[model samples]
Target chain A: MTSAFWAVYLREILIMKRRILRQSASMAVSPLLYVVAFGCALGAAVKVGDRSYLEFLIPGLAAMASMTQAFAIATEINVARFYFFAFEEFQAAPVSPFSYVLAETLAGVTKALYAVLIVLIIALLFGTRLNYGPAFWGALLLNSFSFAALAVALAMLVKSHADQSLLTAFVITPMAFLGGTFFPVDALPAWASAILRFLPLTHAADAARAGAFGLPPSPLPFIILACCSLVFFSLALSTVKKARN
Target chain B: MIKTESLKKSFGRTRALDSLDLEVPEGELFAFLGPNGAGKTTAIRILTGLSFKDSGKAFVAGVDIDKDPLKAKRLCGLATQNVNLDSELSVRENMDIHGRLFSMSAKERRERTRELLELVELWDRADSLVKSLSGGLKRRLMIARALSHGPRLLFLDEPTVGLDPAIRRRVWSLIKTVNQKGVTVLLTTHYIEEAEFLAGRVAFIHEGRIVREGTPGEIALEVGKWAADTFQDGVLKSSFFADKREATEFLAAAPGGGTLRKVNLEDAFIHLTGKRVL
Candidate 1:
């Protein structure tokens, strides 16, 4: 990578380091609450194919956390653009648009990985030890890459800081709930399941649950996620190039 | 060194730059003087490679900006009108990042950061969070950061817009010090006195065109040495004279009393374009 890419990435890392403790706490809260509210409420009495519902919920939460946290980088980008005006600093420098998008997307991936680590710790405390083989991580990484690239593209398209919240509400929030994170998509009607299959998060959650359950890995969801990552990354590059103009 | 020919840019139906032309020699403190929406910032943005022009050619330090923008950008440093520093980072971190973007070595970045911070007299505040500093300190840091890469050309766009008079004068001295060290400076400001005091040459831009360009003294001389101002029906009008005696006589015999003073660059702009820069 170029030094300019590292410079931009280093800046994001430095800011993250300064807020690590608070960020970790924020990342840990919702998963812990979900485990308490849903796991304590329905886990012992429910079973999906002979296992407790808590075991099923853990991987789904992990998938959801990866998507949400990776997409959270948009808030940081919006703050830099609207409040601090720091995006202009990059524009005035010798950094290329591709280098800029790559660095920011990787930074978003780093944040997602950090949030996933918190979910893993929460699962350990709940005594839910699911399989964590290479396939599980590969699916998770692709999922994070896809959402982070999407976040960078959407960030470039937002007009104001407040518009960022609208994107989260309209795009990300709906996907988080409907992408089979809370329940099995197969339980839904055939039409609903078919439509949900189009969402990248649906493939991510399915692949993650399959890996965590020690099932044989299927390549379809991974392929879908890889395609999503490529498309979103290309969109990020084009939007950033337009933003510079 | 910088040069542009027939530069044109439009936003929807509004023209931001219209056949703009400019030339700045190496090591000269050149200023673009214009009011708001007069294309000063737009021209600066295009020349620095931050924005593209519609139809034009621009060269920075002999490198075509459109052909090799990275090379052209590497030769210039820009301090925008707004305070665009990262408020969460320390003063030192901000400068360090800028140096790294220019591919400076760790050791080079360290040495340059110290040199620039000390030059702006902010070395003691290098570890302070940018948000914790006063506005004047933040402005000084912006200038210091722009010079971190040791660029051949420096662009300051309204560097003292929100500063108090005292702080503004301090920045003026810093700018002068930077230029004296052999770095060419291109400054854009609507403050007529700022251009008069700091720039070796001044260009008056109105509606995206250069109306007048010359040394401060040479431009002021075009409107004569003296000016007599008169107010009638809530409208202020000014007349220029080659001699103070002529101005005083006109002021004394005028229908209503008027103020007489030596002419400045603003007077020359008003005389040439019949518009107030402020």
Candidate 2:
């Protein structure tokens, strides 16, 4: 079981190693554009709390990057399932469903961490220095873990490549914009804030922003993110087993 | 090496396998001869632990698949009908991963990969991406990957489904070589000659049940030694006889001239089911 886990992870690492340059560039493009457009051009006149808006936006951008990059693994899974038929190879092997899901989810977390590193690099270049403490890292890891697990479960349920795109459009896109990434969720109406509180990314963005600001860590968001991770990971295991049958 | 008794599987209202029973002894090259939709792939999938059976029992390499699927799976390797190789990776990487799945050491994996690739005559193209290889090369690589773990039993489902005749013959030779090395092989194919040429024992499956099972010569003898095909009013009619002289006499008495040939697995299949294997 341990060997099979590493075997599956090794394949992903090899593929990522070959495409490192291209993937790094792709990861950098969005955050770089967001810094230029929202942080530089629009932030000169606005203030978030006592600091400039760039400082606040940087942590939110980090939160969003972790979500998107982690969820991106579903595209790879779908391509393997629909076109290359590589998932069938694993199905025919002796690898357990738990090992397969764990390996793929870890691969997704790896990609998410890489994207977060790029965001930090961009933040440094923009003169927005934030605290890099354990709380910040914890929130980011939990966020990535939750979304990556969700990606695997949804990848198994989607019937075709088109359905995957629809999932991204409907599920991930809405969460990205409305999950308190661009602005404060508390600034919205009471009803809207109540709804957004249920989103995992909302807690992630809040915890990440608070950690970056060097504020006292609150355990509520961490607790919520951890619960979400466990639920999604369990769902991933079930879906993969169902796919095998 | 393999056995199944009263195995059954169904999808909705359709029965993919129904009360199927089979046994392949160690070191024997067996063939499941049937047309499409005859439950050949389903049976292989169930036996290999890739699928679930509705009822009945299956054993591989002395392991009960339902009770201990991982152990059974480790004892067998399957080359499916589709070319399911990781096209983005090189041939060596593909084989290496399969070895790792079976928990082979790095040294063992390297040695096995080289040995199997050489056996399949693919040593020279080990670094080439699978997508860049020809259809025949991909099939050969799949076979080599299947054997990289040194499995006691190998299941090949339509290993030569869409290849040219010359390439198909080359694949046949590879399968024969693997079987010669003492691996129990269970093959499924619709190609009549593929079974007749390679399998030591062949089972004819139709609509998810085995109609006949025996050696190629034994099953062919069940129909006849010779076949005479005559066309009357644009329809082809076939008649089988045990003696060459009897077939010649029947051909002579036909209203129109016909072709005479030796009986094959297809003839036996058509004689039993009244349908062509194709």
Chain A alone, TM-score for each of the models? Answer: 0.98, 0.98
Q: Score each candidate by Cα lDDT.
A: 0.92, 0.93
Model 2 Cα lDDT, one tens digit per residue, B88-159: 789999999899889999999999999999999999999998889999999999999999898899999999
CAPRI band for model 2: medium
Q: Which stretches of candidate 1 lie over 4 Å from their true place?
A: none
RMSD (CA, angstroms), candidate 1: 1.3
Local accuracy of candidate 1 as per-residue lDDT tens digits, A1-245 = 38899988999999999899999999999999988888768676888777788988888899999999999999999999888889989988999888999999999999998898899899899888999888888888999999999999999999998899999999999998898888899999999999999999999999999999899999999999999999999999999988855
Q: Provide TM-scores for the models.
A: 0.97, 0.97
